[model samples]
Target: MLTIKSVSKSFDNLSVLDTIDLHVKKEEFVSIIGPSGCGKSTLLEIVTGLIAPSNGEIYFNEENVTGTTNKLGYMPQKDVLFPWRTVLENVIIPQEIMGIRKKDAEKKARQLVEKFGLSGFEEYYPSALSGGMKQRANFLRTVLTDKRLLALDEPFGKLDALTKREMLKWLTTVRMETKQSFLLITHDIDEAIFLSDRIYVMSSRPGRIVKEVHVKEKHPRSNGFLLSKSFSELKNELLSSLGV
Candidate 1:
């Protein structure tokens, strides 16, 4: 449902991405894993029209959408929630920006808050929520934007290991229910392997697609799947690709 062809980005004399070619099929979860400063987030920014590529084109539903804004939803590395606003208020801000009536937006947000496990905490401030809860709230806000494809940049990077694992499990269920296409930028190979249908391994800056590994494991993957031989092999393969 999304395609990027021969995409390249440069700032003055420094090049960040080169000859990038990638796609995400409808409802497929794809991940880009690489070293820090490898321009993964920059590529996402280009895809979402926050920035323009020096060369190449982006397509959604086979239509040229390069340099277009609001083509998809974006959730950045940080939650960026307003401490002053309650959870429901934060979730509906996107609709408010799009001219949705306050009553209408709240009605929709309330439903999502319940679905996303934020029902009773709708009136709570960000400071009152745990790290995972805050991230879940942020995810709800992103989902309410009504976009088919969501660009996620290290959405769980700040969480502790246990929290991150729990969130990953929750995300798998989210994917199953929502069936929305995702393009994720992450440094965690295990996270990529566990959640992605396909993983793109990128080289260090002037980032290039060094490898594309398909995770053959089916969705609703049990945690036991993580301990299987197949999972170990995939992890080892990805580790080799990253030169770890």
Candidate 2:
């Protein structure tokens, strides 16, 4: 579980996040969505400890984690996979960084690669994989590292609509298998609705939580879930919340 309490971030005179409060329970998948430049990514960076928050606290399982543990796996807007490294090699980078023995790391990486549908492509480089395949590799890398929490900052933002849908469905499968706490930032309302256990809507500029809605849809949702009336209503509400 992760908790952000009264967290705010400012760059000089510009205030971005304003005392934002949110939480993700164990095994929960949560998302934050707002108009562009709403400090969603900034909030994520603060939680990841890439940047210190201007104010307040971040806790993991009830302990203050500010400037602390490396229990977080952050996937940015881009996969940023090493073009030179093969898929197996890319995923093992985390294990390498953690100083785990090569044999142990490869054993875990092999299982994860196969689980993510990249078993045969393990020897292939980034160039050999499609966008969706690359994202899977990216997610697999994150999963390989931080087995606790996944902080994904718009990982699907760069994909085409059809590819994005496919990624979302695949992502749901991935999350179910991993059971990691995921805090995702997405601009796509449909994507948020399709993937989240709960969705938090943020106000623009000096971002603050405007609304939080629990997604009642079941996990591993069917394709028809996206076409349901409940999905449309929630999407409309999110759009209206964003003032789009």
Top candidate by TM-score: 1
> Candidate 1's error at 69, in angstroms?
1.2
- Residue-by-residue lDDT tens digits, candidate 2, 1-60: 899999999999999999999999999999999988989999998998888999999999
Question: Model 1: runs farther than 4 Å from truth?
Answer: none
Root-mean-square deviation (CA) per prediction: 0.8, 1.1
Q: Name model 2 segments beyond 4 Å from true.
A: none
Q: How many backbone clashes does candidate 2 have?
A: 0
Worst lDDT 10-window in candidate 2 = 66-75
Tell me the lDDT of model 1 at 81: 97
Compared with the true structure, model 2 gives a TM-score of: 0.97
Q: What would the per-residue lDDT of candidate 1 be over residues 73-100, giving only the tens digit for each residue?
A: 9999977899999988998998999999
The 10-residue segment of model 1 with minimum total lDDT is 110-119
